[model samples]
Target chain A: MTTLVLVSHPQLADSTSQQFLKESLPDDDIIWEHIESLSSLDVAQEQAQLRRADRIILQFPLYWYAAPAGLKQWEDTVLTRTFVYGDHRYPLADKELGIVVTTGMPRQAFQRGGAEGVTLDAALAPLAALAHRAQMRWLPVFPIYQFGYLEEPEKLQLVVDYQRYLTQPQPDSLANRQDWFAQRLDGMVARLAEDQRTTGRLIASVFEQNREQIDQLHDTLAMIKEQDDD
Target chain B: MTEQSQWLSQQIDQLAAQQEKFTDRAFWLALKQVVAEQDRRSEQLGGEVDGRTWRPDRW
Candidate 1:
Protein backbone atom coordinates (compact mmCIF):
# COMPACT_ATOMS: atom_id res chain seq x y z
CA MET A 1 0.00 0.00 0.00
CA THR A 2 1.16 3.52 -0.70
CA THR A 3 1.94 5.77 2.29
CA LEU A 4 2.02 9.54 2.24
CA VAL A 5 4.06 11.10 5.02
CA LEU A 6 3.28 14.79 5.34
CA VAL A 7 6.09 16.19 7.47
CA SER A 8 5.30 19.52 9.07
CA HIS A 9 8.37 20.48 11.04
CA PRO A 10 9.21 24.12 10.43
CA GLN A 11 12.90 23.49 11.00
CA LEU A 12 13.12 19.90 9.82
CA ALA A 13 16.76 20.29 8.77
CA ASP A 14 17.75 21.07 12.34
CA SER A 15 15.66 18.36 14.03
CA THR A 16 17.49 15.07 14.68
CA SER A 17 14.40 12.91 15.22
CA GLN A 18 12.55 14.06 12.13
CA GLN A 19 15.66 13.77 9.99
CA PHE A 20 16.33 10.21 11.15
CA LEU A 21 12.75 9.09 10.59
CA LYS A 22 12.66 10.67 7.12
CA GLU A 23 15.85 8.88 6.18
CA SER A 24 14.65 5.53 7.52
CA LEU A 25 11.34 5.25 5.68
CA PRO A 26 11.41 3.07 2.57
CA ASP A 27 11.55 5.22 -0.58
CA ASP A 28 9.84 2.80 -2.95
CA ASP A 29 6.16 3.00 -1.96
CA ILE A 30 6.33 5.96 0.39
CA ILE A 31 5.96 9.61 -0.62
CA TRP A 32 7.42 12.32 1.58
CA GLU A 33 5.77 15.72 1.50
CA HIS A 34 7.33 18.54 3.44
CA ILE A 35 4.40 20.76 4.37
CA GLU A 36 6.57 23.86 4.69
CA SER A 37 7.49 23.51 1.04
CA LEU A 38 3.84 23.26 -0.02
CA SER A 39 2.89 26.88 0.65
CA SER A 40 1.23 26.96 -2.77
CA LEU A 41 0.01 23.36 -2.93
CA ASP A 42 -2.15 22.74 -6.00
CA VAL A 43 -5.42 21.42 -4.64
CA ALA A 44 -5.99 18.99 -7.47
CA GLN A 45 -2.45 17.59 -7.44
CA GLU A 46 -2.43 17.27 -3.66
CA GLN A 47 -5.82 15.60 -3.75
CA ALA A 48 -4.56 13.17 -6.32
CA GLN A 49 -1.63 12.28 -4.09
CA LEU A 50 -4.02 11.62 -1.23
CA ARG A 51 -6.21 9.53 -3.49
CA ARG A 52 -3.33 7.27 -4.42
CA ALA A 53 -2.21 6.70 -0.84
CA ASP A 54 -3.85 4.06 1.35
CA ARG A 55 -2.23 5.47 4.49
CA ILE A 56 -1.46 9.08 5.38
CA ILE A 57 1.00 9.88 8.16
CA LEU A 58 1.28 13.30 9.75
CA GLN A 59 4.88 13.59 10.93
CA PHE A 60 5.83 16.58 13.02
CA PRO A 61 7.69 17.73 16.08
CA LEU A 62 5.21 18.57 18.81
CA TYR A 63 4.94 22.37 18.96
CA TRP A 64 3.20 23.79 22.01
CA TYR A 65 1.30 20.46 22.32
CA ALA A 66 -0.07 20.71 18.75
CA ALA A 67 1.08 20.50 15.17
CA PRO A 68 2.98 23.39 13.58
CA ALA A 69 1.09 26.09 11.70
CA GLY A 70 2.13 24.73 8.31
CA LEU A 71 0.32 21.42 8.75
CA LYS A 72 -2.79 23.15 10.10
CA GLN A 73 -2.68 25.43 7.09
CA TRP A 74 -2.26 22.53 4.71
CA GLU A 75 -5.29 20.81 6.26
CA ASP A 76 -7.40 23.96 6.13
CA THR A 77 -6.49 24.70 2.55
CA VAL A 78 -6.47 21.18 1.11
CA LEU A 79 -9.33 19.47 2.96
CA THR A 80 -12.17 21.65 1.71
CA ARG A 81 -15.81 20.86 2.51
CA THR A 82 -16.53 19.84 -1.06
CA PHE A 83 -13.49 17.55 -1.14
CA VAL A 84 -13.68 16.03 2.35
CA TYR A 85 -17.13 16.55 3.89
CA GLY A 86 -19.78 17.75 1.46
CA ASP A 87 -22.31 16.32 -1.00
CA HIS A 88 -19.31 15.20 -3.03
CA ARG A 89 -17.71 11.85 -2.29
CA TYR A 90 -15.06 11.70 0.48
CA PRO A 91 -11.76 10.85 -1.18
CA LEU A 92 -10.24 9.89 2.17
CA ALA A 93 -12.91 7.43 3.26
CA ASP A 94 -11.57 4.18 4.73
CA LYS A 95 -8.02 5.50 4.46
CA GLU A 96 -5.84 5.22 7.57
CA LEU A 97 -4.54 8.29 9.41
CA GLY A 98 -1.36 7.91 11.48
CA ILE A 99 0.52 10.46 13.54
CA VAL A 100 4.25 10.49 14.16
CA VAL A 101 5.22 13.03 16.80
CA THR A 102 8.56 13.92 18.34
CA THR A 103 9.01 15.54 21.70
CA GLY A 104 11.88 17.17 23.55
CA MET A 105 10.69 15.89 26.92
CA PRO A 106 10.65 12.26 28.03
CA ARG A 107 7.51 10.23 27.55
CA GLN A 108 6.67 10.18 31.25
CA ALA A 109 6.45 13.95 31.27
CA PHE A 110 3.27 13.77 29.21
CA GLN A 111 1.34 11.63 31.72
CA ARG A 112 -0.96 12.61 34.58
CA GLY A 113 0.78 14.36 37.53
CA GLY A 114 3.76 14.82 35.26
CA ALA A 115 5.15 18.12 34.03
CA GLU A 116 2.79 18.34 31.06
CA GLY A 117 -0.10 16.93 33.13
CA VAL A 118 -1.85 15.83 29.94
CA THR A 119 -1.40 12.46 28.27
CA LEU A 120 -0.10 12.25 24.73
CA ASP A 121 -3.49 10.95 23.62
CA ALA A 122 -5.21 13.93 25.19
CA ALA A 123 -2.89 16.28 23.37
CA LEU A 124 -3.67 14.69 20.01
CA ALA A 125 -7.42 14.18 20.40
CA PRO A 126 -8.23 16.78 17.77
CA LEU A 127 -6.32 14.87 15.09
CA ALA A 128 -8.19 11.70 15.97
CA ALA A 129 -11.49 13.51 15.73
CA LEU A 130 -10.47 14.99 12.42
CA ALA A 131 -9.80 11.48 11.10
CA HIS A 132 -13.25 10.42 12.28
CA ARG A 133 -14.87 13.42 10.63
CA ALA A 134 -13.06 12.64 7.39
CA GLN A 135 -14.15 8.98 7.57
CA MET A 136 -10.61 7.75 8.08
CA ARG A 137 -9.41 5.07 10.45
CA TRP A 138 -7.28 6.63 13.18
CA LEU A 139 -4.18 4.58 13.78
CA PRO A 140 -2.13 4.93 16.92
CA VAL A 141 0.13 7.93 17.41
CA PHE A 142 3.82 7.14 17.35
CA PRO A 143 5.74 9.33 19.81
CA ILE A 144 9.47 9.81 19.86
CA TYR A 145 10.45 11.14 23.24
CA GLN A 146 13.70 12.82 24.20
CA PHE A 147 15.24 12.12 20.83
CA GLY A 148 18.44 13.91 21.73
CA TYR A 149 19.02 11.63 24.72
CA LEU A 150 18.83 8.33 22.82
CA GLU A 151 22.10 6.47 22.38
CA GLU A 152 23.48 5.15 19.09
CA PRO A 153 22.04 1.67 19.52
CA GLU A 154 18.63 3.01 20.45
CA LYS A 155 18.72 5.23 17.38
CA LEU A 156 19.53 2.24 15.18
CA GLN A 157 16.68 0.21 16.68
CA LEU A 158 14.35 3.13 16.14
CA VAL A 159 15.30 3.28 12.49
CA VAL A 160 14.59 -0.42 11.99
CA ASP A 161 11.31 -0.38 13.92
CA TYR A 162 10.14 2.84 12.30
CA GLN A 163 10.87 1.49 8.86
CA ARG A 164 8.82 -1.61 9.65
CA TYR A 165 6.02 0.55 11.02
CA LEU A 166 5.93 2.62 7.85
CA THR A 167 6.11 -0.29 5.42
CA GLN A 168 4.46 -3.27 7.13
CA PRO A 169 0.83 -4.05 6.20
CA GLN A 170 -1.79 -3.98 8.97
CA PRO A 171 0.90 -2.60 11.29
CA ASP A 172 -1.44 -1.76 14.15
CA SER A 173 -2.43 -5.36 14.85
CA LEU A 174 -0.45 -7.67 17.13
CA ALA A 175 -1.23 -10.63 14.88
CA ASN A 176 0.23 -8.77 11.91
CA ARG A 177 3.38 -8.02 13.93
CA GLN A 178 3.72 -11.70 14.75
CA ASP A 179 3.32 -12.56 11.10
CA TRP A 180 5.95 -10.00 10.14
CA PHE A 181 8.46 -11.53 12.57
CA ALA A 182 7.58 -15.02 11.42
CA GLN A 183 8.10 -14.03 7.81
CA ARG A 184 11.45 -12.46 8.69
CA LEU A 185 12.51 -15.64 10.48
CA ASP A 186 11.45 -17.73 7.50
CA GLY A 187 13.42 -15.50 5.17
CA MET A 188 16.50 -15.79 7.36
CA VAL A 189 16.13 -19.56 7.44
CA ALA A 190 15.82 -19.68 3.69
CA ARG A 191 19.06 -17.73 3.23
CA LEU A 192 21.08 -19.84 5.69
CA ALA A 193 23.88 -22.10 4.50
CA GLU A 194 23.57 -25.85 5.08
CA ASP A 195 25.23 -25.88 8.50
CA GLN A 196 23.25 -22.87 9.77
CA ARG A 197 19.84 -24.34 9.01
CA THR A 198 19.79 -26.27 12.28
CA THR A 199 19.79 -23.12 14.39
CA GLY A 200 17.14 -21.54 12.21
CA ARG A 201 14.97 -24.64 12.52
CA LEU A 202 15.39 -24.59 16.28
CA ILE A 203 14.15 -21.03 16.51
CA ALA A 204 11.20 -21.73 14.23
CA SER A 205 10.31 -24.82 16.25
CA VAL A 206 10.20 -22.78 19.46
CA PHE A 207 7.82 -20.30 17.88
CA GLU A 208 5.58 -23.10 16.61
CA GLN A 209 5.58 -24.88 19.97
CA ASN A 210 4.70 -21.71 21.83
CA ARG A 211 1.88 -20.91 19.42
CA GLU A 212 0.43 -24.41 19.89
CA GLN A 213 0.51 -24.07 23.68
CA ILE A 214 -1.11 -20.68 23.54
CA ASP A 215 -3.84 -22.01 21.23
CA GLN A 216 -4.49 -24.96 23.54
CA LEU A 217 -4.76 -22.61 26.50
CA HIS A 218 -7.27 -20.50 24.61
CA ASP A 219 -9.32 -23.64 23.88
CA THR A 220 -9.23 -24.64 27.52
CA LEU A 221 -10.48 -21.20 28.56
CA ALA A 222 -13.30 -21.40 26.05
CA MET A 223 -14.37 -24.80 27.36
CA ILE A 224 -14.29 -23.58 30.97
CA LYS A 225 -16.42 -20.59 30.04
CA GLU A 226 -18.95 -22.87 28.33
CA GLN A 227 -19.11 -25.17 31.35
CA ASP A 228 -19.61 -22.25 33.72
CA ASP A 229 -22.47 -20.90 31.58
CA ASP A 230 -24.19 -24.29 31.47
CA MET B 1 25.89 -20.08 14.05
CA THR B 2 26.90 -16.44 13.84
CA GLU B 3 27.00 -14.49 17.11
CA GLN B 4 23.71 -12.77 16.38
CA SER B 5 22.02 -16.03 15.42
CA GLN B 6 23.38 -17.74 18.53
CA TRP B 7 22.03 -14.94 20.69
CA LEU B 8 18.65 -15.22 19.04
CA SER B 9 18.67 -19.00 19.47
CA GLN B 10 19.43 -18.58 23.17
CA GLN B 11 16.51 -16.20 23.50
CA ILE B 12 14.26 -18.77 21.82
CA ASP B 13 15.42 -21.46 24.25
CA GLN B 14 14.67 -19.24 27.22
CA LEU B 15 11.25 -18.42 25.81
CA ALA B 16 10.57 -22.11 25.18
CA ALA B 17 11.41 -22.96 28.77
CA GLN B 18 9.01 -20.26 29.96
CA GLN B 19 6.31 -21.57 27.64
CA GLU B 20 6.42 -25.09 29.07
CA LYS B 21 4.50 -24.07 32.21
CA PHE B 22 2.72 -21.08 30.77
CA THR B 23 -0.45 -19.91 32.45
CA ASP B 24 -2.54 -17.04 31.02
CA ARG B 25 -0.73 -14.52 33.17
CA ALA B 26 2.60 -16.21 32.52
CA PHE B 27 2.00 -16.06 28.78
CA TRP B 28 1.38 -12.33 28.90
CA LEU B 29 4.36 -11.77 31.16
CA ALA B 30 6.53 -13.85 28.87
CA LEU B 31 5.36 -11.91 25.86
CA LYS B 32 6.09 -8.63 27.59
CA GLN B 33 9.53 -9.84 28.58
CA VAL B 34 10.27 -10.89 25.01
CA VAL B 35 9.19 -7.53 23.70
CA ALA B 36 11.32 -5.76 26.30
CA GLU B 37 14.33 -7.84 25.35
CA GLN B 38 13.79 -7.04 21.70
CA ASP B 39 13.70 -3.36 22.55
CA ARG B 40 16.84 -3.67 24.61
CA ARG B 41 18.60 -5.50 21.82
CA SER B 42 17.51 -2.90 19.34
CA GLU B 43 19.07 -0.22 21.51
CA GLN B 44 22.21 -2.29 21.89
CA LEU B 45 22.36 -2.53 18.11
CA GLY B 46 22.03 1.26 17.66
CA GLY B 47 18.35 1.21 16.76
CA GLU B 48 15.73 3.56 18.16
CA VAL B 49 12.36 2.56 19.59
CA ASP B 50 9.47 3.67 17.44
CA GLY B 51 6.47 5.55 18.86
CA ARG B 52 3.50 3.78 20.47
CA THR B 53 -0.21 4.05 19.68
CA TRP B 54 -2.10 6.31 22.01
CA ARG B 55 -5.78 6.15 22.91
CA PRO B 56 -7.27 8.86 25.12
CA ASP B 57 -9.55 6.48 27.02
CA ARG B 58 -6.60 4.41 28.25
CA TRP B 59 -5.22 7.40 30.10
Candidate 2:
Protein backbone atom coordinates (compact mmCIF):
# COMPACT_ATOMS: atom_id res chain seq x y z
CA MET A 1 0.00 0.00 0.00
CA THR A 2 1.21 3.52 -0.80
CA THR A 3 1.81 5.84 2.15
CA LEU A 4 2.17 9.63 2.16
CA VAL A 5 4.35 11.07 4.90
CA LEU A 6 3.99 14.82 5.35
CA VAL A 7 6.98 15.94 7.39
CA SER A 8 6.29 19.28 9.08
CA HIS A 9 9.39 19.97 11.16
CA PRO A 10 10.46 23.57 10.49
CA GLN A 11 14.07 22.52 11.00
CA LEU A 12 13.82 18.96 9.69
CA ALA A 13 17.41 19.01 8.47
CA ASP A 14 18.60 19.50 12.05
CA SER A 15 16.13 17.19 13.84
CA THR A 16 17.91 13.97 14.78
CA SER A 17 14.68 12.02 15.18
CA GLN A 18 13.05 13.19 11.92
CA GLN A 19 16.23 12.71 9.95
CA PHE A 20 16.69 9.17 11.30
CA LEU A 21 13.05 8.32 10.64
CA LYS A 22 13.31 9.61 7.07
CA GLU A 23 16.40 7.51 6.46
CA SER A 24 14.72 4.41 7.90
CA LEU A 25 11.65 4.49 5.61
CA PRO A 26 11.83 2.30 2.51
CA ASP A 27 12.43 4.22 -0.73
CA ASP A 28 9.63 2.35 -2.57
CA ASP A 29 5.85 2.76 -2.19
CA ILE A 30 6.17 5.80 0.05
CA ILE A 31 5.99 9.49 -0.85
CA TRP A 32 7.70 11.99 1.46
CA GLU A 33 6.65 15.61 1.48
CA HIS A 34 8.32 18.32 3.55
CA ILE A 35 5.49 20.73 4.25
CA GLU A 36 7.75 23.54 5.48
CA SER A 37 9.76 23.44 2.24
CA LEU A 38 6.75 24.47 0.14
CA SER A 39 7.36 28.08 -0.87
CA SER A 40 3.86 28.25 -2.27
CA LEU A 41 0.95 26.02 -1.39
CA ASP A 42 -0.52 24.20 -4.43
CA VAL A 43 -3.91 22.89 -3.27
CA ALA A 44 -4.63 20.72 -6.31
CA GLN A 45 -1.21 19.07 -6.25
CA GLU A 46 -1.50 18.40 -2.52
CA GLN A 47 -4.97 16.88 -2.96
CA ALA A 48 -3.68 14.71 -5.80
CA GLN A 49 -0.94 13.33 -3.57
CA LEU A 50 -3.49 12.56 -0.83
CA ARG A 51 -5.71 10.80 -3.37
CA ARG A 52 -2.85 8.50 -4.36
CA ALA A 53 -2.03 7.47 -0.81
CA ASP A 54 -3.70 4.64 1.14
CA ARG A 55 -2.34 6.04 4.41
CA ILE A 56 -1.38 9.63 5.30
CA ILE A 57 1.09 10.34 8.11
CA LEU A 58 1.53 13.79 9.63
CA GLN A 59 5.01 13.77 11.10
CA PHE A 60 6.00 16.70 13.25
CA PRO A 61 7.86 17.70 16.35
CA LEU A 62 5.50 18.81 19.11
CA TYR A 63 5.31 22.60 19.27
CA TRP A 64 3.44 23.95 22.30
CA TYR A 65 1.66 20.57 22.47
CA ALA A 66 0.41 20.84 18.87
CA ALA A 67 1.65 20.75 15.31
CA PRO A 68 3.61 23.68 13.88
CA ALA A 69 1.81 26.44 11.93
CA GLY A 70 2.91 24.96 8.60
CA LEU A 71 0.96 21.71 9.12
CA LYS A 72 -2.04 23.61 10.51
CA GLN A 73 -2.07 25.86 7.43
CA TRP A 74 -1.88 22.83 5.13
CA GLU A 75 -4.90 21.33 6.84
CA ASP A 76 -6.91 24.57 6.57
CA THR A 77 -5.95 25.16 2.93
CA VAL A 78 -6.03 21.62 1.54
CA LEU A 79 -8.59 19.57 3.45
CA THR A 80 -11.61 21.52 2.25
CA ARG A 81 -15.22 20.44 2.83
CA THR A 82 -15.82 19.38 -0.78
CA PHE A 83 -12.87 17.00 -0.71
CA VAL A 84 -12.85 15.80 2.92
CA TYR A 85 -16.35 16.16 4.34
CA GLY A 86 -19.80 17.13 2.96
CA ASP A 87 -21.89 16.00 -0.06
CA HIS A 88 -21.34 12.27 0.58
CA ARG A 89 -18.08 12.59 -1.38
CA TYR A 90 -15.38 11.89 1.20
CA PRO A 91 -12.22 11.43 -0.87
CA LEU A 92 -10.27 10.34 2.19
CA ALA A 93 -12.78 7.73 3.29
CA ASP A 94 -11.27 4.33 4.08
CA LYS A 95 -7.80 5.85 4.18
CA GLU A 96 -5.83 5.93 7.43
CA LEU A 97 -4.60 9.02 9.30
CA GLY A 98 -1.51 8.57 11.46
CA ILE A 99 0.52 11.02 13.51
CA VAL A 100 4.21 10.69 14.25
CA VAL A 101 5.17 13.09 17.05
CA THR A 102 8.43 13.81 18.84
CA THR A 103 8.86 15.50 22.18
CA GLY A 104 11.92 16.83 24.01
CA MET A 105 10.19 16.10 27.33
CA PRO A 106 10.01 12.61 28.78
CA ARG A 107 7.00 10.43 28.00
CA GLN A 108 5.77 10.48 31.58
CA ALA A 109 5.39 14.27 31.56
CA PHE A 110 2.38 14.12 29.24
CA GLN A 111 0.12 11.96 31.39
CA ARG A 112 -2.72 12.93 33.75
CA GLY A 113 -0.61 13.04 36.93
CA GLY A 114 2.58 13.96 35.12
CA ALA A 115 4.21 17.38 34.87
CA GLU A 116 2.24 18.29 31.73
CA GLY A 117 -1.06 17.30 33.41
CA VAL A 118 -2.50 15.84 30.14
CA THR A 119 -2.02 12.72 28.10
CA LEU A 120 -0.52 12.77 24.61
CA ASP A 121 -3.84 11.53 23.26
CA ALA A 122 -5.59 14.50 24.86
CA ALA A 123 -2.88 16.87 23.58
CA LEU A 124 -3.38 15.72 19.99
CA ALA A 125 -7.18 15.57 20.17
CA PRO A 126 -7.58 18.11 17.38
CA LEU A 127 -5.76 15.93 14.88
CA ALA A 128 -7.89 12.95 15.85
CA ALA A 129 -11.00 15.11 15.43
CA LEU A 130 -9.79 16.14 12.00
CA ALA A 131 -9.43 12.51 10.99
CA HIS A 132 -12.92 11.76 12.28
CA ARG A 133 -14.42 14.73 10.44
CA ALA A 134 -12.74 13.59 7.23
CA GLN A 135 -14.09 10.01 7.61
CA MET A 136 -10.61 8.52 7.93
CA ARG A 137 -9.46 5.76 10.28
CA TRP A 138 -7.28 7.25 13.02
CA LEU A 139 -4.30 5.09 13.81
CA PRO A 140 -2.51 5.16 17.17
CA VAL A 141 -0.05 8.02 17.77
CA PHE A 142 3.63 7.13 17.37
CA PRO A 143 5.56 9.06 20.02
CA ILE A 144 9.31 9.52 20.14
CA TYR A 145 10.17 11.06 23.49
CA GLN A 146 13.50 12.72 24.33
CA PHE A 147 14.98 11.71 20.98
CA GLY A 148 18.16 13.72 21.50
CA TYR A 149 19.21 11.64 24.51
CA LEU A 150 18.63 8.13 23.16
CA GLU A 151 21.64 5.85 22.79
CA GLU A 152 22.67 4.19 19.54
CA PRO A 153 20.85 0.89 20.25
CA GLU A 154 17.62 2.65 21.27
CA LYS A 155 17.81 4.86 18.18
CA LEU A 156 18.30 1.81 15.96
CA GLN A 157 15.31 0.09 17.55
CA LEU A 158 13.27 3.27 17.13
CA VAL A 159 14.09 3.34 13.42
CA VAL A 160 12.83 -0.22 12.94
CA ASP A 161 9.71 0.36 15.04
CA TYR A 162 8.92 3.66 13.29
CA GLN A 163 9.13 2.01 9.88
CA ARG A 164 6.80 -0.79 10.99
CA TYR A 165 4.37 1.69 12.61
CA LEU A 166 4.06 3.58 9.30
CA THR A 167 3.69 0.53 7.04
CA GLN A 168 1.95 -2.09 9.23
CA PRO A 169 -1.57 -3.02 8.13
CA GLN A 170 -4.57 -2.95 10.48
CA PRO A 171 -5.36 -0.58 13.35
CA ASP A 172 -3.07 -0.30 16.33
CA SER A 173 -4.58 -2.77 18.77
CA LEU A 174 -2.99 -4.99 21.41
CA ALA A 175 -3.69 -8.10 19.38
CA ASN A 176 -2.13 -6.64 16.23
CA ARG A 177 0.97 -5.55 18.15
CA GLN A 178 1.27 -9.01 19.68
CA ASP A 179 1.00 -10.60 16.25
CA TRP A 180 3.74 -8.35 14.91
CA PHE A 181 6.07 -9.35 17.73
CA ALA A 182 5.18 -13.03 17.24
CA GLN A 183 5.94 -12.79 13.53
CA ARG A 184 9.33 -11.24 14.29
CA LEU A 185 10.05 -14.00 16.80
CA ASP A 186 9.14 -16.62 14.22
CA GLY A 187 11.58 -15.13 11.73
CA MET A 188 14.31 -15.08 14.35
CA VAL A 189 13.61 -18.69 15.24
CA ALA A 190 13.87 -19.78 11.62
CA ARG A 191 17.38 -18.38 11.34
CA LEU A 192 18.77 -20.04 14.47
CA ALA A 193 21.28 -22.93 14.31
CA GLU A 194 20.19 -26.48 15.23
CA ASP A 195 21.92 -26.22 18.61
CA GLN A 196 20.06 -22.96 19.34
CA ARG A 197 16.67 -24.31 18.24
CA THR A 198 15.69 -25.20 21.82
CA THR A 199 15.73 -21.54 22.87
CA GLY A 200 13.67 -20.69 19.82
CA ARG A 201 11.12 -23.36 20.72
CA LEU A 202 10.83 -22.00 24.26
CA ILE A 203 10.31 -18.48 22.98
CA ALA A 204 7.66 -19.70 20.50
CA SER A 205 5.80 -21.48 23.28
CA VAL A 206 5.80 -18.30 25.36
CA PHE A 207 4.50 -16.32 22.42
CA GLU A 208 1.72 -18.83 21.73
CA GLN A 209 0.60 -18.59 25.35
CA ASN A 210 0.56 -14.79 25.15
CA ARG A 211 -1.37 -14.97 21.87
CA GLU A 212 -4.09 -17.00 23.58
CA GLN A 213 -4.55 -14.28 26.20
CA ILE A 214 -4.65 -11.55 23.53
CA ASP A 215 -7.24 -13.53 21.55
CA GLN A 216 -9.38 -13.88 24.65
CA LEU A 217 -9.22 -10.13 25.22
CA HIS A 218 -10.24 -9.48 21.59
CA ASP A 219 -13.16 -11.87 21.87
CA THR A 220 -14.36 -10.23 25.08
CA LEU A 221 -14.20 -6.80 23.45
CA ALA A 222 -16.20 -8.04 20.45
CA MET A 223 -18.83 -9.57 22.75
CA ILE A 224 -19.17 -6.24 24.58
CA LYS A 225 -19.72 -4.47 21.26
CA GLU A 226 -22.33 -7.06 20.24
CA GLN A 227 -24.17 -6.55 23.52
CA ASP A 228 -24.11 -2.80 23.03
CA ASP A 229 -25.56 -3.21 19.53
CA ASP A 230 -28.35 -5.42 20.83
CA MET B 1 23.39 -17.36 16.09
CA THR B 2 24.04 -13.84 14.82
CA GLU B 3 24.13 -10.77 17.08
CA GLN B 4 20.70 -9.64 15.83
CA SER B 5 19.28 -13.10 16.50
CA GLN B 6 20.70 -13.03 20.03
CA TRP B 7 19.06 -9.66 20.65
CA LEU B 8 15.78 -11.06 19.33
CA SER B 9 16.00 -13.95 21.75
CA GLN B 10 16.54 -11.55 24.64
CA GLN B 11 13.52 -9.54 23.58
CA ILE B 12 11.39 -12.70 23.32
CA ASP B 13 12.42 -13.67 26.83
CA GLN B 14 11.45 -10.24 28.13
CA LEU B 15 8.09 -10.43 26.36
CA ALA B 16 7.43 -13.84 27.92
CA ALA B 17 8.16 -12.42 31.36
CA GLN B 18 5.81 -9.53 30.68
CA GLN B 19 3.03 -11.83 29.47
CA GLU B 20 2.93 -13.69 32.78
CA LYS B 21 1.78 -10.52 34.56
CA PHE B 22 -0.34 -9.06 31.75
CA THR B 23 -3.75 -7.47 32.34
CA ASP B 24 -5.44 -5.07 29.94
CA ARG B 25 -6.14 -2.31 32.44
CA ALA B 26 -2.79 -2.41 34.21
CA PHE B 27 -0.76 -2.85 31.02
CA TRP B 28 -1.55 0.63 29.75
CA LEU B 29 -0.95 2.19 33.16
CA ALA B 30 2.36 0.41 33.50
CA LEU B 31 3.39 1.48 30.02
CA LYS B 32 2.67 5.11 30.87
CA GLN B 33 4.69 4.87 34.06
CA VAL B 34 7.67 3.30 32.29
CA VAL B 35 7.65 6.01 29.60
CA ALA B 36 7.44 8.73 32.23
CA GLU B 37 10.42 7.39 34.13
CA GLN B 38 12.66 7.06 31.05
CA ASP B 39 13.74 10.69 31.04
CA ARG B 40 12.63 11.86 34.47
CA ARG B 41 16.12 11.90 35.98
CA SER B 42 17.65 13.62 33.01
CA GLU B 43 14.94 16.26 32.97
CA GLN B 44 15.27 16.82 36.69
CA LEU B 45 19.00 17.35 36.27
CA GLY B 46 18.61 19.84 33.41
CA GLY B 47 15.58 21.69 34.85
CA GLU B 48 13.15 23.45 32.55
CA VAL B 49 14.50 25.91 30.00
CA ASP B 50 12.57 28.84 28.57
CA GLY B 51 11.24 27.83 25.13
CA ARG B 52 9.58 31.12 24.14
CA THR B 53 12.36 32.19 21.78
CA TRP B 54 13.34 28.66 20.71
CA ARG B 55 12.75 28.50 16.99
CA PRO B 56 12.80 25.06 15.32
CA ASP B 57 15.03 26.38 12.53
CA ARG B 58 17.50 27.82 15.04
CA TRP B 59 17.78 24.55 16.99
The best candidate by DockQ is: 1
Tens digit per residue, CA lDDT, model 2, B1-59:
33533554465444433432222112222332222332242233223222322338756
Between which residue pairs do clashes occur in model 2?
Answer: A108-B36
Per-prediction TM-score, chain B alone: 0.39, 0.33
DockQ of 2: 0.03
Per-residue CA lDDT of model 1 for A1-230, tens digit only, reads 89998999888788877877776775448999998976598888888999999989999988889999999988888888888879657789999998889898898899999999888899999999889988998887888999899975466557645655666666545445545555555654555456656755776665555445444554555665575476
Most TM-score-accurate candidate: 1
What fraction of the correct interface contacts does each predicted structure contain?
Answer: 0.04, 0.02
Q: Which stretches of candidate 2 lie over 4 Å from their true place?
A: A172-230, B1-59
Task: Tell me the fnat of candidate 1.
Answer: 0.04
Error of 2 at A176 (Å): 5.2
What is the C-alpha lDDT profile of model 1 across B1-59, one tens digit per residue? 33654566565444434432222112223333344444444343322111121325546
